[model samples]
Target: MTDITDAAKRLLLGKPMSSERLGHTLLPKRLALPIFASDALSSVAYAPDEILLTLALAGVAGTIWTPWVGLAVVLVLVVVVASYRQNVHAYPSGGGDYEVVTENLGKNAGLAVASALLVDYVLTVAVSISSASQYVASVFPALRGSEVIVAISVVVFLTFMNLRGVKESGKAFAIPVYMFMGAIGLMAMFGFFQYLTGSLGEAESAGFVLTTSEAYDQGLVGLGGALLFARAFASGCAALTGVEAISNGVPSFKRPKSRNAATTLLMLGTISASMLTVILLLAMETGVKYAENPAEQLRTVSGGAIPDDYVQHPVISQLAEVIFSGAPWLFMLVSAVTGLILMLAANTAFNGFPILGSILARDGYLPRQMHTRGDRLAFSNGIMTLATGAIVLIWVFDAQVTKLIQLYIVGVFISFTLSQLGMVRHWTGKLRKASDPRERSSMRRSRVINVIGFLLTGTVLIVVLITKFTHGAWITLLIMALLFLLMRSIRKHYDSVIEELALGDDLAAARALPSRVHAIVLVSRIHKPTMRAVSYARATRPSVLEAVTVGVDENEIATLQAEWQKMDVPVPLRVLNSPFREITRPVLSYVRSVRRQSPRDLVVVYVPEYVVGHWWEQLLHNQSAIRLKSRLLFTPGVVVSSVPWQLSSSQGHGVETTYFPQSGQPPAMEDRKR
Candidate 1:
């Protein structure tokens, strides 16, 4: 049975490769773009909506200002892209924002950036999946209530695809990503043409009059109007959420990694900015409007209320419906592509989160497992963790994109603002040392660009906090705080472990030979396992060796002694009486007594353990051995060894037990008794 299980595991995981093969999984620029830039590119789908939705709060008057707001957002996006291109070129080691801030702004600033990016990555998954669910529900009305489940399912599916390998998954993602770009681009072009020809019409919901809530009904007359516009601009800044992903993934690119990554960033910025501008322009031309609660905000000509069940499609959905009025298939195609792109947006988190986790893990800010790549050369554990967290968020929030969007862009902008500030410092430091006139000029120009980026993003961050903090950004901040604490705790633990393992002043003296070596074989019964354990212990040639057993019953104790004598065992057996049937206590007491007798000696306790054929067999045996080993581990100057007895049920069937070693060390099975 053990053989069969081992074989099954081998078949499932495949053969292990040398660590050197990890480089084979590295991605080229083409693959890296889709792998890491999907989020930023996909943001064009909903960033326009967020902008328009925020403006919709002011009624038709506010909607007219969307183009100006979009242009401002586009400018920020362009500046941010230019700033990050410099970053990718300057710090292409994949340290990204964390590295930049750490190098220039000090460690605490770097940690803050790390914490923000970590939280942002989580929100990226949650928001993208939730938005995808909304798109799915828009296309198929029957899936309305099941959005959470559908969103979670998509996250899980993307997690597996990423776990397979970055290169493989990138190939799969390229087509849909490009198709999404093409479809949206085509829609924008057609909408632009229609507007030129004076043929554009209002969306299906555009006929309904909007009843602005009391908070935003006032015209642009006072400070409140300016604040409202700031809020709208803040929401529009969601377009910049995924811009830093390329910098974080620079190392994943092939030859000239930095240049390729910079190029990819340029492409991502251009495509995303262009697409977003066109989408917003077309939405306004087509008179598309989206309301958080349509039934409440919308009224008919006769003042009749729209039904609660009325499905108000997303801005993109409504625009698609108008653009493809005659060709139903085109609308469905666009809808399908939009949903697919949103889901693929989760792939950006899939790639970035694990890589960032690995970097943090290497810095001792995360569990060590996060630093280790899997069979597919991906951070499998980190990927699964991201997927699980996303699924939980999706379920908890009921996969409502509008609700999740409020918690989105804030964390990302926090990281972006800090990162750009760090870059400004970075270029400033470089300029001081740069002797070459041309290089100094270039560095100064880069510094100016980053300074502008820092100012713009920092202002947006403040706006987001003011506008969104009370709404749901507080929850995001709470999550970031929790994650920051978690990372600090992990770092502390690793530091403590390192300190404990460090060589000390007494190292030479501690390494000196023990005055004596005392060995004992723990036996539960007079059986082959016990006999083999005794034999193995005697082979160690300790100063003293003996077999010890805890006698819980008088009859069994006498029978064991009789059988031991009758069998003429090579080692003498010593039995301890357990009045309370406490196996570990009795064994520990006897070992402590031996240690007290010879304080300078080392006590080696050999535990006779059974190798189980199945998981259930573990419960049937070795309970005392496990308890004994646990207690012995904490004892000073003591070495606990397990002498396993492989049962007939555990052997034979060509099992490969060599791959996964026990406890991250080489398997000690070779020292065990057959």
Candidate 2:
């Protein structure tokens, strides 16, 4: 069974590589761009839709400001990218936001950043994959209602690919990512070229009139409009979700890791900014209309409602239809790659989350298992964990990107604001110690950039919380707060355990020998297993030894005594009465009595257990012995030892018998011979 499972694993993940091969897995700049920047770049596919959707509430008058909102988003993206470049250079250990905040702001502040980033990474996968499924469904209308299933399937696929190793996944994803870039770049250039030549046509949704909601009938005129614009801006800032991934993944790059990572960050910011600008510009120019409910929010010029079956395509799809109308194949190609890139964007989170989880685990905030590398040298446990989280969110949200977007960006901005604030502190501390003139000037410049970054991101964070809190952002904040408390509790536990296990000047006293050793063998009947336990107890050469059992029935006790006399057992047997047929409590009471009789004695309880081969056989045997062993383990100065008698069915399963010493020293050679 084990061999079959291992074969399946090898088929899926390939053979295990040696730890020395880790360096060989380092990504080059070309590969790292796609691996770490896909999320930020793919935001182009959905960020514009979110911006337009939020504005559609105020009707067409509000939608005209889409370009300005996108530019605002781009500005924040630029500052965040620049700020994180400093982070990667200064803290190349790949701690990213959590490390920066922890070192500069303190542990509690750092934990806050960690909690936010962790929640953000999960949402990144959920939102990205869910949007990708939308694109897929748009192209294949038959799959429209099954987006949740499709998104989950894609997540599973990506998880397995990542488990194969980071570099391997990077190589596989590089082509599709570059193809997406080319497709979008070509579409943008074609759209602009057609616009310059006075040949670009309006989108299919252009003829429809967007009706304003009653709350915004005045349209971009007062306090309500201002709040709506801020909401739009906050929604557009989804473009910045994946910027910190580059900083979190610095160690994955080749030699000169920090420089490569920073370069990638610059490239990501440029490409994402350019893509977002072009998409939004073309969306507005071509008169693309997207709404939360198109059937209700859209109307004809005569003030009549549109058809109930009308499907409001995403902004990019509408733009593609208008820009690439002449070349149907080009439109399909763009749509396919857009979907592919959105799905691949989750790769950024997959790369970032595991590394950050490992850092948290190393710091004793998460389970220690999260810190270990798997067979493929990936944080396989963290990858699986992130996938599970994303899957749950996808299932619960029904893969609705619009609803999920309301919950997005809040956590990223929290991390962003705190990270930039930490960078400011980091550079300030550096400036005080730097006496060199050139270094001081550089530190001062970096400080200025981070300060601006902090201001912009902090404002955006506030806007996000205010505009989105009632719209689903509160769910994210609640999760982050819960995670923060959970991590703090875990750290406290780890610290308490460390304090308890710390050896002091009384080490010799802790290791002092007991005055006497008392051995007890638990028996059910005079069988080979019981005799084996008795023989092992006698070999221990304790000061006192006895065989004990629970007498549930008088007839059974009499039969056991007859068999014991027939076998001429050397050890005296004592039976404890149990009117209720309770096995564990009586054994525990007897062990305590023995300990009370000799206060300074060590009691070793030898339990006879049946070793079975198949899993089902376990349910049929060793039921009483298992319960008694668990109870005996907590008694003071008591040791529970198991003497296994392998059944006939257990043979040919590679099972072996070995002796283990309870003491801290190796057993004598004579014991080994026995």
Candidate 3:
């Protein structure tokens, strides 16, 4: 069974690499771009849709502002990337926003930033995969209503790919991500060329006008219109979702990690900004109309209401349809790669979240299991956790990109604001300690850049909260607060444990000898195993030894008493009755009572257990003895030991005849067969 399982694992994930070979997995810049930058670049698929969807609440006039909103988003993206480049250089420890905030702002602030970024990473996976499923469903209309299942399956696939090792997954994803980029670039360039030649055409939906909600039917003539545009700007900021992944993953880069990370950050910002700009312009020029509910919000040019079956495709789909007009394959190719890239975008979060989780776990803020690397050198616990959280979000939102998107950007902006604030303080502190003129001037310039980042992200945070709080952003804030408190509690527990373990001048107390030894063998039935336990306890030469049993059934206790007397054992037999028929509680109470009477005396308990060659036979015996031994260990001044008697079924299995089960024994089988 073990050989088959191992062979399957090797076939699925390749040969398991050793810890010494971990450095062989460090990524080059080309692979790192797809692994780290896909999320930010792929947001072009949905960021424009969000901009158009939110703007559609007002009227067709509202869609005209898509370019300006895209520009604002681009500017914020630039500042964030520049500020994080400074972070990767200064703190190249790969702590990312959490490290920066923790170092400059102290532990509590750092915990807050960690909590926010952790939440952000999970949402990045959810939003990206959900949007990708939308694109896929657009290409295949038969899958329209089952997007949730498709999104979840893609998430599981990504999790398996990531668990294979970071560089392995990076190489696997590089081509599709680059193909996506080239496809978008080619589509946009061809689109513009045709526009210059006066042959560019409108979207299929361009003829059908979008009717605004009653509140905005007048079209940008009131105070409500201004608030709607602000909301649109806030939603479009989704393009910056994965911008911090490069900073968080500096350690994964090859030799010059910091320099490579900075370069990657610059490239990510540039490509994302350009793609977002081009997509927004194409949507505006082609008059692509996307509404939250197209059946009700859309009508014919002759003023008739559209049918309820009308489906509103996203901005990119609409643009691809027009740009690749005659060439069906080009449109299909663009659609296929677009869907794949959107799904693969979650890989950036997969790469970043686990590394950050390891850092947090090492700092005692999360479970220690997360700190350990798997055979593939990935944080296996963190990967599983991210997958679980993203799947839950996908399930809750029914894989609707528009609804899940409402919960996006809040956590990223939180990390962004805190990270920039930390950078400003970092540079300021450096300038104060530096005496060199050149270094001082350099610090001054970096400080100005971080300050701008701080202001920009801070204002966007307020706008996001005010516009999206009631919609879904508050759920993110609540999750962040809960995570912050949970991490604090974990740290408090680890600190208390450390304090308790600090050996002081109490060595004399630990070395004190006990007054006497009392040996008690826990007997379940008068069998060979019980006789062996009784014989072993008597030979120990203790001050006093006796056989003890819990009376679970009256008739069974009577039979055991008769058999013990027939054996003529030297030790006395004591039977404790349980009116409620419990084993562990009665034994625990009796052991504690002995310690309460004589605090200095040591109580030793010997439990008789069965060792069977076959797995199922072992479960048939030693049930009560195991529980009693466990309960006795927790009693003060007590030592619990097990004595094993090999059953006849164990003779031919090359058994070790040990008292305890082997550590490699399958725990699930014990639980199931027992």
Candidate 4:
């Protein structure tokens, strides 16, 4: 069963990649763009809708702020992208925010950034997959309420693709990303032309009168109203969610790594901002309206409430329908590309999470398995972890993009603020050391840009916290705090182990030798394995040698004793009685007594174990031998060795066999000849 499972996994995930081939997987800029930028680019799909939905809580009257909110998000996106371009250029080691914060702010601050980025990566998958499922549901109404299941399945599919390798995933994602850009870009262009010509028609929701719920029925009137406007802006900042991914993936780029990474970051910023602005503009031109509770808040021209089953589609879907008005196929194409890009957007997290995780692992903050590349030279462990987290979040939130979005940008902005602060410090330090005039000017210029970025993102971070805390962002902060404590504890553990094992002043401890050697061979019966272990242990020429076996049955012990005498074995056969029919305990007791008798001597326990070819055959024998060795290992002044005798069933298998000098053969062969 184990073998089959392993084989199936290999077939699904492909064969393991060798360490030498990692360099071969480096991504060119075109492919790198999609792998690292898809998350940011795809956020355009939902960011505008988020802005409109939040504003619509005050009825259609409050929805006029959509353009201004999108502008604020776009401005912030540009500064962040510019700031991270410097990051990719300066610290192209793929540590991203963690390395920058650590180098400038200190270890604790760096861990804070690391925790935030880790959380962001997880939320990226959850939000992107959930949003993608929403688009899928928009296209196929039959799958409407099954959003959580669909989101989880897509996460699994993306996880499988990423496990295949970075380069492979990038290739697969590039087409949809570009297609999405072309489709949306053309739709935006056409929608704008029609708006300019005064020929554009109103959206389907243009006629519906939105009545603000009782909670906000007064509509944009005081300090409470002002905070509501700011909250909408904060939510719209979801457009900036993936700007840091390029910095985290700098090392994955091909030749001129830093430059390619910086260029990619620039492209990501431009494309995402463009798409976001266009979508919001088109939604306005098409008069697209949304409501928090469509069944209640939405009313027809005659003032009747819409049915509970009325499905309110997203802003982009509504715009696509108007832009491709007569061409149904093109509308379907728009939806397909939107859904495809959103699903693949999780690929950005797949790329960034593993690289950052590998860096964290190297620093001893996470498990070492995260540091190793998988069969395809990707961080498979980290990929699986991100997928698992996303699956849980999708299930919990029931695949609602709005709920996930509240938790999404908090970590990302936290990272953005810290990373920008680090860059400011980085530039200031460089400025202090520079003697050349041109270099000094460059440093000062970079410092100014970083300072602007720090201020913008820091404000956004505060806004996100104050505006979104009660709405689910607090959960993200709590998880980050817990992760911070856990990482610090792991670092403390690794540090303590290093300090204890340093061996700085004690050379004698390293060269200590045993005063004497006492070797014992463990046996179940006078079989080939037992004889082989006895032969191998005797070759060591210890001060003492004995063959020990537990007598679980008297008749078997008698037969073994008779055969031992008949064979005239060179060593003494000492049988121990197991009153409880226990194998490991009695042997442990005997070894401890021997050590008690001779404190300075080393007792080497040789355990005879069978080697089998097939997985099922492993259970047929030597199960007790494995347990005996494990217990013996912790005993003071003891060494345990396994002497494996290959059974005839092992032929043609790849389990390595080493022939020890003159280990015994099965005595049954000699008996048969007699």
Candidate 5:
């Protein structure tokens, strides 16, 4: 079983890369762009849909504001990109927002950013994968109801690909990411060309009359109307989700890491903003209509209910269908690549989450195991942790992009606001210390950019909180708070442990030895295992030695005594009465009594255990011994050790077999009969 599992793991993850090969995993700018920017790049696919969906709540009057809201989101994206470019140049350690905020705003603020980023990374996977599943369903209508399953399967696949190693997965995903870019770019070109030539056609849904619900029957008016647009802009900000990933993943880039990372960030921002602008423009020109509840919110021009079997495809799909009306294959290609990119978009989180987790772990904010690299030189624990989180979220939300998206962007925006604020502080500090005129001028300019970024992101953060609070954004904020507290608790525990274990100046106290060692061998029967336990205990050369057992069965005890007396074993056997037949309690009581009698003396309990070859054999033995050892471990001056006796079935299963002197077989097995 172990061999098969190892083989399967190797087949899936590929052979483990040595630590020396870590340098080879560094990503070039081309690959790093896809690895770190896929999420931001792919968001153009759904950000428009979200904007239109939100505006649709106000009916047709609301949908007309899509372009303005999209432009607003793009403005924030560009500023965030510029702000983070400065972040990379200043703090190139790949700690990203956490490091910058911790350094400038103090540790508490840093932890807040860390928790926010962690939550956002998780949402990135859930929302991106769920959106991808939607695209898949659009292509193959038969798979519509199974979006949850499809999304989870894609998550597992991405996890496996990432576990293989960053460089390997980056190479594999680069093609799909570029294909998505090409497909979108081509569609945008053709879409605008057709519009310029007066040959563009209306969307299939263009003929459908969108009606206002009671909530927005008065149209975009008063406070409610203002709040509605705020909400729409907040939703469209989801496009900026992956922009910070580049800052977080700076170390993954090749030499000139900061420069390459900054360049990639600019490229990502430009591409994302352009694509979003084009998509929204084309949607408006094509008269696309998208709603949170399509069937109930949309009706035929004749005022009749739409068919129950009608499917409302996403905005990109609708745009493709109309823009490529003469070419059916282009529409399919557009849909396929959009889905492919959305799925690969999760790769950004896969790459960013682990690195951030490792950084947090290194700072004692997470489990130490998260800091360790796996066979592939990746933070495997963190990768698996992210994957598990995403799968749970996908399952809980039923893989609906609309539902999952409600919980998205809240976290990324939180990080963005704080990180930009930190950058502003960082540049201010640099300017204060700089004497060079050129350096001071550059610092002031960078500071201004970050100041603008902070104002914009902070305002958006407030709008997101106020507008999306009841719409499931509150859940994200709650989770971020809990994670903040949890990380604090973890760091406190690690700090306490460190302080308690720190070396003191008292050498004598540190090197003090126990007065004496008392050894006890636990026996279940007068068999080879018991004999081996006795022999090993005797070899320890303790001041006192004895064999102990619980009196579970009188008749068996009598028979065991008879055999012991007949063999004249050197060690004496002491049995503790267990009227209730509780092995662990009686043994624990006896060991504690021994410790109480000699406070300064050391007590060692040797347990005889079976060495099993198969997994199932583990269940048949040593359960009571395990329980007893666990109890004894907490007792002061008490030590627990296991003495293993391998059975015939335990051979050739990887564990080394040791032949004890008291065993029937010779050390070399020369005298044993086959």
Candidate 6:
């Protein structure tokens, strides 16, 4: 029997969990909708702010075009959702876009999508936590400079929840997710009712006089104006960041995985689109406006100066204040819920990056340890890596959502474009093989959707690069390139190791025993361990055998020789002098000389080792034998074995127990009894 150590037992806590238990970690459609869709859905919290801030570059009149930008983003969103529905049905292995592009296209294209999604997952954690921090700061002004700490703390909390396992985290997030949806829905409903009653009032920031930046001073009538519109559209596309998570998570769904995932995607699209559209329309109807430099762009219409100390609250806060109409409790509830939901958005990446890492590990593209699930069946290593990366980003960017926002959305669009391109190829291949007319028609329709998705996402990608690359998107691209090279090197190393370990016909010839056997027993004192070593070696029936000890002190050597003679041991005892008291070097030189004497023979060195229960016991004894064994391992054609003798302290401790019989014979007591 193999004695499992405590460390080994702890490390394998969740090994070999059944696939059926995996379903318990598997998400139902209702919980899955929020778990996977939170990223895209929560974008409504900040996407409008991005759009308005970009349009504000051209002053208030430029902001008038915000509704049109929202409309364009919605059109693109619809096309992407329809196209990915085809992707789910066609390739639902949960490799998501990475596998699809790599399989249909080539490795380079697939790697490109993988790099993009990797960067996107990082930014998702950074941006969501930062935005949530801003919401918290609005309610509690004391947390102003501590935003980075707050954001990183939230990320760490989510990481631990995810490490507990997928189903556990999903259930934890269900209530807050639903509350977010309900709060946003109620706010939108009341705002719409106020508008219908002809009693809707302007946002808190509405009456501030607008000032245009030099880039947008021309006010919507020139080349600069068109470019500003493109920039705003690109920024608004931030809402699409989490769309690909569903395709990556298809395997985590209940039975009919793809269909359930596709349905969840549709629900995600409908709810996100409706909420975003309603928010933008209400912002327009309520005369809400935003600026990157709020203090500079905003002024009192009464010719009084707006306070320099005033912090411009987020668009959600401003809108909620007006909609709730002095109902302080309702206002507080909505703000709290929104902040909580945004923090939970990090859960999307928490679930996503680990699952993708496990797939890559299985394919030899990542460290194999990532494939090992933890006590709760979660990928703990991947989760820790994700948390560390997100924390570094949050700190480096100072947890400013507006600044970090510029680096967002570029990766997701790159993946969207490539994945849609892959789907186009998939449908084309199916069309060529289909003999039935109905199947051919369906393939053709799917191809059309994918083509449109490709075009739309490609355009958005280009616009984001043009607008945001200099701001911060280039940094994200560089990070992705580094990760790509890293994963490639890891895969190469694994492949090389596998090749080195492969067996061939030469192994049999190598396994044959040498023509002769010579054994040497290493002894320090004539104790039980030393006796055990001698007995085990003699049982091997070697052609030659001797007991050797290093002579470090003359008195000790004389005492040992007397003890050996008194016992009248059958084995001849030999002692080697060590002038410098260097045990390892003398033993190594002696073993080499013996091997040279019989070059064709095998040399087996047996060193008796003491097995101690406590680690500290090792420090007090066995120094010479340990050093000798270490040197012997490097010698060619030498097999070193340890004959363990458990100490009195080691007994009843269940330490270093073994079940294998001795090399050639049973125990002396057992042989006597027989």
Top candidate (lDDT): 2
- Can you give the TM-score per candidate against the true fold? 0.94, 0.96, 0.91, 0.94, 0.96, 0.86
Pairs of residues at least 3 apart in sequence or in different chains that clash in candidate 4: 16-375, 17-375
Order the numbered candidates by lDDT, best leading: 2, 5, 3, 4, 6, 1
lDDT of 6 by residue, 318-367 (tens): 88888997697788888888888899998888878887888888877778
Candidate 6 yields a Cα-based lDDT of 0.86
lDDT for position 169 in model 3: 97
lDDT tens digits, residue span 331-359, model 2: 88888899999999999999999999999
**Candidate 1 local Cα displacement, residue 174, angstroms:** 0.4
lDDT of 6 at 314: 82
Better of 1 and 4 by TM-score: 1
Give the residue spans of candidate 6 off by over 4 A: 1-20, 302-305, 505-507, 510-674
Q: After superposition, how far is residue 109 of candidate 3 from its true place, in Å?
A: 1.4
Error of 5 at 343 (Å): 0.8
Which regions of candidate 3 fall more than 4 Å away from where they truly are? 1-15, 307-309, 511-517, 531-544, 552-572, 578-582, 610-622, 642-674
Off by over 4 Å in 1: 1-18, 307-309, 505-507, 652-674
The predictions' CA RMSDs to the true structure, in order, are 3.0, 2.3, 4.4, 3.1, 2.8, 4.5
After superposition of all CA atoms, the RMSD between model 3 and the true structure is 4.4
Report lDDT (CA) for all predictions: 0.84, 0.91, 0.87, 0.86, 0.90, 0.86
Question: Cα deviation in Å at residue 110, candidate 6?
Answer: 1.8
What TM-score does candidate 1 reach? 0.94
lDDT of 1 by residue, 77-143 (tens): 9989998999998899999999999999987788888888888888899988888888898889899
